[model samples]
Target chain A: MAEKLLEIKGLKTWFKTDDGVVRAVDGVDLHIDRGETLGVVGESGCGKTVTARSVLKLIDMPPGRFEAGEILWKGRDLIPVPAQEMDKIRAREIAIIFQEPMTSLNPVYTVGDQIAEVLRQHDKLSRKQAIAGAVEMLRLVNIPNPGKRVHDYPHQFSGGMRQRVMIAMAMSCKPQLLIADEPTTALDVTIQAQILELMQEMKDKLGMSIMLITHAMGVVAETCQRVVVMYAGKVVEEAPVEALFGNPRHPYTQGLIRSIPRVDRAAAQKERLEAIPGSVPSLLNPPVGCRFAARCKFAMDVCVKAMPPLKEVGPGHRVACVL
Target chain B: MSEPLLSVRNLKKHFAVSGGVFAREVDRVHAVDGVSFDIGKGETLGLVGESGCGKSTTGRCILRLIEPSSGEVWFQGADVTRLGPDAMRALRRDMQIIFQDPYASLNPRLTVGAIVGEALQIHGLAKSRKALEERVLELLETVGLQADHMGRFPHEFSGGQRQRIGIARALAVDPKLVICDEPVSALDVSIQAQVINLLEDLQEKFGLTYLFIAHDLSVVEHISTRIAVMYLGRVVEIAGSRDLYDTPLHPYSEALLSAVPIPDPTVKRKRIMLQGDVPNPIRPPSGCHFHTRCPIAKPDCSQRSPELVEKRPGHWVACHYRG
Candidate 1:
């Protein structure tokens, strides 16, 4: 078996609001092998982002707390590590590219300066060397005229270019894993494809693993080797990409795949999209048993009474639902 | 054939930008220039483009939410472009809009019942309080929301549910033409499909026409009978959905189509990365606005703008090199 670059076991993150505790990520388990791309998919507020943030300890801790979890990076448990140690792990072993580049980047600094800050802090490079590295990173992401664009502020660049700059900055340290949270959500479809292609190239060249969080199954089908389906802060299904798309086991996964509009199929012949009825359950009072039971068409009595443990149904395929 | 529901001809909205306090009117953002399209009765026409391409402005101009600098807007055979505020207010019953951001578009202070029934009250659709409550419940049910939830505030609902409420509000006035301005862009993928399906069902039941403006190609292809590709506030290509996707004649359209990722992993798509960022809207490129980034730009592209011409049956493309 390939060595696991990142292993997440029984990860549970919660937000303590005045009203109640919101279990954002409850007993989620996933693993990304070295040099592999894992796609994490779910509807909005499904805890896909919370899972990603937990890997980096990026969640704000005032109201948010990491209740219980073990994120193992290269055999090191990131969850129990001290803050000082976790900082080194964050800068060297794992990096993240956020969804909105306009907000992720600082407005006060030039694009180059922002990127250089990352390199200088992590790699301990001189200011001059860091600037050169920033330009080099920009070129790697295929930003043309990087020499001039380096001095431009974030607002000066278009959405696509800003995304490229974000990617450049994230990859500046050549981390072992890159967690991209809906990196293409804010971009046009054309620009989205370009960014995805660029990420694929970077992965191939750098041999870095990726945890891609997106709501678009089309993106997962295209880019991911492995897929995890989350529903209301829990993983309902996990499988290889082909298996998930070809024979989705969980009802939520099946409904999600059936909902996407495809161009290849005849429009009139296509069935009315089968949406998973009802919205994602509230995390503050998430349902017992399967979180998806409320919306699952095939719900049984067992589904509502007790939480289902993720069971291995086939080789590398796991599902957490009482069928 | 019945008269078209909405006809927009030579619609233009340009914004003058001054360089400084003393600077002359140095540039104009040709946000929407000479864009023309018609929405047939009970048909959905999808207007698609990248950000800053003026798809939203076109929708706004037709609704007169933002007055166009110049154009002809003919609704039900009447010239609505020249209408004053009072006339426009009277005409508002025939046209309504559903904005993209559900949370931002909705007034948070109001309850769901008030938000949905506000239009009915303003238009005097219901006289008694009891009559308004009944109508509001009917509207909520039409969009798949429960009547019991009417007393709840906007923040109480999820993004998907909030959008449904927005849709219900738009339908409250019994409008013949609904301008959906990227209504599903802010939604999760599964929720987007649900909303699109709901929109389609509502149109069929109400015999309504929709001018759907979005940046997503696949979603547009699935929902629209006809699709128009816009570039720099100009319509670059327009055709029936199948023809446009199968054999896009315009260079920009071809590039745009090629960028959409096929959900199937076996199908490898050749991605055409357009060079340079979208030019500043304040000083859009002269002549053919897309020439600067267009893959196949002839010398004539710089000298004169191309007019939309029929290359195939029911397919129009604006390109100097459309052979």
Candidate 2:
């Protein structure tokens, strides 16, 4: 119904490792609508980051390859796009922010210089105008006394402030889509709240779609309108945020939701959290059929015998598990 | 608290920052300033705060891993801070720690068995090689690792598996009080649950006391019988887990609780977000350290610090207002 901004269909990005092929992003299908926040959630090795990185063509060519599937941006497939063309597409049409703000930023450069560089390259603005625009961007991100703070180096800012500067740089080009990969993972709970709030404000102000890649279920529940649960390089479940949390279809999804201990429930006697048994199967030479079958309590003989296709289970809800 | 198993009084750890040509002490980061608490026998006291709040520092001070600038650490009726080298070494047998990053904490050169058994050898808990091997295998199995994993290196295991190894090593000492410093923070959601359950099981089985330090409120609440909220190296509030969540007496605690991203989307929340990042610890706020960001801060809040007072039965808060 709503206009699609970014659509990833059955995309498989694998890395050629010595141990074997690492099926990082195998058979993943997900999409982001205009002005919507789509949360991609999974554990550390679930390929959520790889999928996000693949969209920007950021992976190393020698070791990584898009073995199968299509990435559609505004009805145009991006897999065939030239390297040089992708450079233009990046930061201008779609920008990204990484988890570690301390490393991603250039410590030597001033905050203003970093932000202005993005504007000058993409917007092609004059040096004076770009510097002025940088201050304005800093103010937009709620950095106090932007005019003075903009001239400060990355080290001058705290972890939370550095993340704000990163956001300002990413939004400088006014990209249609913004991809944040664990942007608040390194931050404290209070600071995380500030950053998440700033992101929502920025998104609403710019009318841009955000692909928030995070492992925190609470973060997804608060910020995302829709969610895609990834497991072992596959989209285990996809649904609206309400549907995903209210009635999780996939066993993996249910396990993840239940894994989070609740404060309200903590009033009662401490109960053992229903933790999912077993670790994620190795991405290298992944198991045949459903990757989650080994850990799934409801897994049947048929589940391990044949790969289950992602099927629509309910209205606007899709699941990869046969059950 | 009936002679708590461990009691800390006026604990303070200040890290000096050097600068200029001669590297003079420019300033000091008041990491843990005047923090006091007691952990009863077999009780879990969850220490919670933001990144710079010094929860980890407090834990380390208790174990003498990081020497405190000033404090009295009384464990098992003896002052740990005043103990001699041999006495402290002996005390270490009752106070073991599990670090946050499992990858860095475990020795890479040592095999799993060697690493877990090292504690046994140091404490002289095992009589012979045969007994040591038997104990190591039992500890490994208790933490849900296979006997075959004993020969493998730290790199051979995943994050979850590595964490289990770290836990096994901690338990090898048979410590009466285990300081878990963000033990589950590095693991995935599902694995985090598994580890939490394991810790609880081990706690009950061995009658172990824990000082759980983490940034996540929900996890702390779920695991802890009592929770202490810290801000700017000071304990702002301490209460029963349910009381702290249900009726936070301090403004900082209220804001901190509200900031936690609730996993249920259906539960609409009103987040009381504080402005600006955590102030520099080297030059923390003069009075109430949180007054700068406190929404209800008064003139007196900036001029004088508020003493933590019991606002309700078993609930302590340090705010000038609220209760």
Candidate 3:
């Protein structure tokens, strides 16, 4: 078995919202082996982003609180680490790529300069060497005419190019783990493919583990080796990509798999998709027992009475359901 | 086909790009350049493209939300482009629009009932206050929302519920046509399916025609009777949904379809990934709009633009190389 690069155990991240405490990450246990790609799939407010943020201690304090969890990075607990130490680990050991590159990238600064700044701050490289390294990073990500485009402002670059620049910057420090939260959601399909391809290439070239956070199951099936299905801030299912798609154990996962409109010739005749009936439960005062019980078709009395713990159903396949 | 419900001819929307201190018009961004299509009565026409590809612009042009630069918008039997404000107001009764972001599209201060009833009141469809309330409640139920939800604000509802409210508002006027601009893109995977299914159910029940504009090919394939692929302000491919996805003729359409990551992990596709970014529409490539990124480009591709020509029965393609 491959060595584990990151292991999250019983993680619980909560936020103090106006209504009450929102259990954004109720209890998520996930692990990523070295050089592996793990996809965390969930809808908006499912707490996938919150879980990713907790890995780096990026969540804002006061409102955001780590209730009970162990974010183990290379066997070291990150939850209790000092802010200064956590800052060092961020971007050096682990880096994140956001959904929107326009807001993420500095509008005033040139893409090259911004990338170089990361290298300079982390590696303590000279200005000239850092700029050279930045250009090289851009080249690595397949940006054309990196030398000239390096001087161009963010506005000059298109959405896809800006995303590429973001990838270059994130990959500049050569982190052991890359956390991409909806990285290609903002880009067009063609550009999204290019970015996904670039990320795949970067992962292979650098031998880094990627925790892909996206709502799109297609993206997960295409990029991820293992898949983690999250709902209402909890891990409902985890399995290898093939197993998850082939035979989804959890009701929520099953609903998601069935809901996506397939482009395959077989699905050409499908008139109506199997859309899940209800919306995701609010984190604030979430329903008792199974978080998905209200919307789940297979909900039993036990499911509504108490939450099911994540239990292995098959080899490397876990599901959180009484059934 | 009984003169098709909506016919757009040479539709173009160009925004002037001004530079220098003088703010003079240096060029124009050809958002929707000479794109033409027809939507038969009670048929769903899916407009798909990457961001900045003018899919949304084309939809907006039909409703005169963003006035087209030059085009003939033939709705029913009248040229909507020439309609005065008062006449256009009357036309709105027969046509409505559903926006992508349900949160932003709705008025935060207004109750759900008011939001849905506003359209009916504006169109003079409701006879009395009680009648308006009853109609609003009926619309709410039609969209899978409860009567209690009518009293709630937008913030009280989830993203999916907000989308339902948007749908209810669109259906309030009993419009013949609804321009749904990326309606489900803003929704989650599970919620997206719900909205898509609701749209389909509503379409069948009311015999409502839809110009569904979205970027996701798979989602577009599910609801659309016909699909139109746009690239940089031009319609590259337009065909029946099944035919277009199964056997895409245009290089752009083929590449775009190939890029859609299928949820099934077992399916491995040979993706014809295009090169580089979508060229700036302000200074678009001289010939074909997609020639800069066309994977199967020839010498002539950069010299002359291709007109949309019917390649097969009910299938139109704009490509020099494609038969």
Candidate 4:
């Protein structure tokens, strides 16, 4: 059996807004195998980003709080770790890249300096050695003329190149796991393809596990080995990528798969897209039972009375619906 | 047969790039470089490209939102480019646009009722105060918004609700041709389906024509009868959506279609990724704009430009090779 890389059990993350407590991530559980890619699929405010953030302790603590959960990394609990220890784990074991490279990167600093800083802080390398390491990292990401381009500022690089620099900095410390939150959402299709290909190459070379958070199902189908579907701050379905697309059991998951029109399919044959009615449930006052019951076509009285538990419907495929 | 509803001939929009101490115009960014297309009555034409490919610019030019450097825009057998301000304002009543970001596009201070009814007031569609309020209520209901949402501010609504309000406002003036610029790109997956269905329903009810401009090929393919692929500042190929996706003609179109990540994990695509970034529009590749990054470029590709020509009956391609 493959070694378990990370395991999240019954995680509940909440935020105290002026209106009420926003249950951003409620009772979510997932696991990733060693050297495998796990795709977290959800729309805006579905708690996918918050769930990834909680794994790294990246959520702001003033209003954000972890209610109950266990984030087990190689059988060790990460939720209660001290900040000092967590910092080391963040730099050496897991690194994250964000969607908007322009806002994430500091405009004042040169790309080389930013990358070198990561190496110096994590590995405690000398300044001269760290500079050389930054150049090598840039080259690994396939940036042309890395030596000269390394000194350029963030504004000097284009959107795609800036994202490559972000990838280089994230991989500088040789982390065991990488969390990419909408890493290619803001990129052009061509640039997105290049970045995804580069990440695939780097993953094979380094033998690291990846947690890809995105709303695009196409991306998940192309890159992920396993998939987790979230709706209204809860996990609705989890399965292997092929099984999820081939035979989606959950109603919400089925709706999402049907909604995305395929470029390879003829649209005229279908009268219109199969759309789920209504909108996502509000986090402040989420529905009493199934969060998707308001928009689901297969809702029942039982679904409105109690929240469903994740049960294995097939081998390695789980769904959280009563039906 | 009758003439097409909209015919754009040789449309070009060049933005001047300024530099140095004096900020003098040193060069021009050829945004929409001499593009032409025709859309029949009640047909949806999709303009697709990466960022900076000028798809949005072409949409804006037809509405006269941005003045084109040189072009002939014939709408309903009238030359829109030659119209005076008063005549242009009248033409605008029959043409409307939906922006990408609903949060930024809407007025924060105004109530939903006023936002949607403002267009009716401008065009003097309402006959009386009570009639105007009734019309606003009717428009809200048409867009799937409840009557209670009239007094709510923009911030009080969700992203999907805000977009419905935008659609209602566009429909208030009874426009014949609507330009949807990435309407669902900012929406969640399920919410995107709802909005798309709403657009389709409204179109059927009103017998409307649409110019759908988007980067996602799947969404574009779903809504468009015909698709035009753009690169840099020129259209490389145009054909029926199914034909274009099944067997693309131009090299650039083939690369673009192959880059779309499909939603099925079992299907492996033969991705033909172009090398290098899109060249700067101020000084695009001397002849063929995509030559710098074309995977199968010939020596003559850099010496002469290819004219857009019909290869198959209804398919058009601008390339020296393949087509």
Candidate 5:
């Protein structure tokens, strides 16, 4: 296997509120190989986004705290890195494309200026050089009329176009690892495909790894090689994309896959949709043992008694369930 | 089929946009234009489109939530388009709408019971205070919510729970037709299935017809018996769910279908990457509105507008390149 670009081990993130402590991300472990795409799939409040933010140390710290974790990026421990050093890593080594483009990009700055700012910060390039590089990055993402669009503000662009600009900004510094947190969730399907294709192309051209966090299993199937399924606040399952889709070890994964309506499946006259019975457990005071035990149809007494650790079910396939 | 439940013809909604201090109508946003469709009794029709495509506007227009500039909205042999305010208010009992954002739709100041019971009070369904309380509990239970939750406010519940309350409010009047306007789009993926199943169950139990409007095609396919594809305020294609997905005759439909990523990795789908953003609704491309970004557009596509024609049984498409 190629060298791992990013490795996360025993990561835990928690948010303390007046009501109680919310374990947003609890004990998530994964690795992203160089030039590979790893998908993190989960419903809202499953800690998927939190896990991504934790990797980047983007969480606000007074109420939100990183309990324990080792985030190894290119053999360096990101967790123990100094704040100033981490800032360097964030700008030069790791970049994130947030879910909402409208809020992510500064409205006051032109798209070109935003991208140029990143280049200027990391590479210490001149304004002219940075602007040229920004235009190049825009063109690299397949944005048409890049020269003209670079001068346009975020609002001047459409939702899809703004997303493209975000991607361009994220890639301006040419980071080794890109964290795309639900980048296409807000986009329409047609435009989503375009954005996904652009990301895939950028991955190939830039030789950058990606940690894509999204709820859409279809996006995982299309772009990712490895998959991690999260429920409530823990990693329920992790496997190769093909293996996970073909034989979902976790019941939650099975329900998610079955819920997605496919054209081929519709043609086969499948009337019974495999919907999970109950809603996701509340993050504040999530159930002990299995977080999904409340909703899991196959859950047993062991599932309720004690939390199941991710046990290796097969080679490279791990599931955290007591079935 | 026993006089379709609802029929819409040549529906058009135009919003005036002011330019400057002159306050002149610089442009009219053609939110919905020349759209027509019919829903069979007790059958769900999914209106699938991207943002700014007018699917939601069409739903709002049918309910007279927003007045249409020109169109005919006929419901059960009555021309509802010409109905006066009092007549429309009376007709509202038969037509209800479940908004997209559960958080925004429900009033924060009101409790769940009052929110659900308000509809009943409006239509005079409940005679007294006791009857209203009983009816509110019944509505909550019908939508899979607890009777005790009636006392809680919208913020007290999760996204799925709030949506259930929204559904309860919509069903309070015993509506014949419900317009579910992207009701599940704002929900978590796992919770989405639960809500969808709830909607399907309610539809069956109440013999209700749904005009389901959403940008997500997969969700629409799961619930809708028939599907209509809209683009730039026009109905590009309409057909049975199976037929539309199996063999989409319209180029736009084909592109939209191709854009949906299949969850199965074994099945390789050719993603049709539509270039450019959705054309400005205010100045949509002349003739065929989709010609600007359509992958299979011909020269005549710009000069001649194509009318929706039935190419096969129960399948209608509007395109110049059908041959």
Candidate 6:
């Protein structure tokens, strides 16, 4: 078995909102193997982002808190780790990249300066050395004329280029794990391809695990070795990428995969996409039963009576449905 | 084969980016430049491209929502570009648009019934209050929303529900052509399929034609009978959905299609990585707008422009080297 780099067990990251206690990442259990790419797939409000944020303890306190579970970074629970310790672990051992590049990057500073700042923070390099390191990082991400473009501001680069800059910054410290929250969601298809390829190249070169959180199954299929499907702040299904796509036991997983209109003859011939009806339940006042039961075609009396437990069906394939 | 319901000739829309001492037209962003296409009665034409490719601009231009700087828009034997405000108002009854952002499109202050009914009121389609309320309820039900939702505000509903409300409003005018501008793009993946499938069902039931504008190729492929690939304010290729997917004519189209990651893990596709970011629309590449990033571009590709010429019986391409 591959060595576990990061293990998250029964994580319950909830937010005390004005409405009520929002169970954003309610009882989630997942892990990332060393040098493995794991995809966390779900729609909005499914808690994929919350789960990722919980891993880094990035969720703001008072409003947000980890109610339960352990974020095991190499078997060491990071829950009790001090703020200063987390600051060290963040860019040095584990790093994160958000969906929107523009928001994630500081606009006032140059791309090179921002990257060098990260290096200076974690690696503790001199200003001159860090600047040189920033240029080298830019080159790794395939930015043309990196030396000159290093002086350019975030706004100076296009969306794709900005994303590349973001990637360079993320990879600068050479973290063992990278948490990408829909890294390419804000990009075009061509640019997304470039970014995904660059990510793959970076992972290969640096030998790092990636926890890629995205809603698009095409992206999951293309990059992830194993996949976890989330619904209404809970894990609905988990499996190896091929097994999950080939034999999706969970009704919700099946609905998601079937709904995506593939660019091929076989998919085009299908009369219509099998859209999962109804909407995701509000986390603040979530349903008493299975979160997906309302929209599930395979829901039974028992499914609505109680939330089902995750049960193993096949090798490395687990589903949280009664069926 | 017959008189197209809509025919656009050399449509162009430019926005002046002014700065410096005087707010003169320092530079013009060529948003939609020299684009032409024909949509036969009830035919769905998919317009697809990246962020600055002007697919949305082209859709808006068809309805004269964003006035074209230069173009001829012929619909049912009349020139839409030449029509006065009153004439245009009358014509708008036949042309409706579904906006991308559901949250922004629907009036938060207004009730769902009021929002949907406003169109019928504007066009003076409803005979009485009772009739209008009944019709609004019927429209609500048609898009899979309960009649009880009619009295609620836009904020009360989810993104998918709000989108349905938007759809119901668009259908109120009894439009013959609907410009669906990334209607499902804002919704979640599972919800997106619902909207895409809903659009198709509505198209069939109402005999409505659609100019579906989106950046997602797969979603566009599922709905559009014919697809037009765009790049930097120009349509590089147009073909039947299957033809475009199976054997793309233009180098750009081929690259664009290849870039899409197929969902199935077993099917290993050779993704053609596009070299760089989309060039600035303010000062687009001189000849072939795509020449800057195109892998197969030649010297002549920069010196002269390529006309969109018919390559096959029904297929068209704008490339110097393509057959």
Question: Best candidate per lDDT, number?
Answer: 2
**TM-score, cand. 1 vs. native:** 0.96
Q: Candidate 4, residues B134-251: lDDT per residue as tens digits?
A: 9999999999999999999999998888999999999999999999999998998778888989998988999899999999988888888889999888999989888888889898
True contacts kept of each: 0.56, 0.85, 0.86, 0.81, 0.68, 0.83
Lowest summed lDDT window (length 10), candidate 5 chain B: B314-323
Model 6: CAPRI class: high
Candidate 1 lDDT over B1-323, as tens digits, reads: 14678888999999887787787777888999899877789888899999999999999988888889999999977889988888888789989999999989999999999999999988899989999999999999999999899999999898889999999999999999999999999887778878988999999999989999998888898888889999999999989888888888888888888877766666667877877667877777888999998888877788899898888777888887884
Clashes by residue pair, model 1: A289-A306, A289-A307
Computed on C-alpha atoms, the DockQ of candidate 3 is 0.80
- For DockQ, the strongest prediction is 6
**Ten-residue stretch with the least lDDT total in model 1 chain A:** A264-273
Question: Which lDDT tens digits does candidate 6 get at residues B1-323?
Answer: 24589999999999999998888879999999999998888889999988989999999988988889999999988999999999999999999999999999988899999999998999899999999999999999998899899899999989998999999999998999899999899989889989988888898899999988998999989998889998888999989888888889898899888988889999898878778778889999999998887788889999999999999978999999887
lDDT on C-alpha atoms for all candidate structures: 0.88, 0.93, 0.91, 0.91, 0.89, 0.91
- Evaluate every candidate with DockQ and list the scores: 0.61, 0.80, 0.80, 0.76, 0.68, 0.81
Model 5 CA deviation exceeding 4 Å by range: A267-270
Which tens-of-lDDT digit does each residue in B1-323 have in candidate 2? 44599999999999999999999999999999999999999999999999889999999999888999998998888999999999999988999999999999999999999999998999899999999999999999999999999999999998888999999999998889999999999888999999999999999999999999999899999999899999989999999888889888899889999999889899888989899888889999999999999998989988999898888888988888878
What is candidate 5's lDDT per residue for A177-234, written digit by digit as tens? 9999999988999899999999998889899999999998999998999999998889
Instruction: For candidate 4, give the lDDT of residue B273.
Output: 88
TM-score of chain B of each: 0.97, 0.98, 0.98, 0.98, 0.98, 0.98
My TM-score estimates for the predictions, one after another, are 0.96, 0.98, 0.97, 0.98, 0.97, 0.98
Q: What share of the true interface contacts does candidate 4 keep?
A: 0.81
Tell how far residue B9 is off in model 5, in angstroms. 1.1
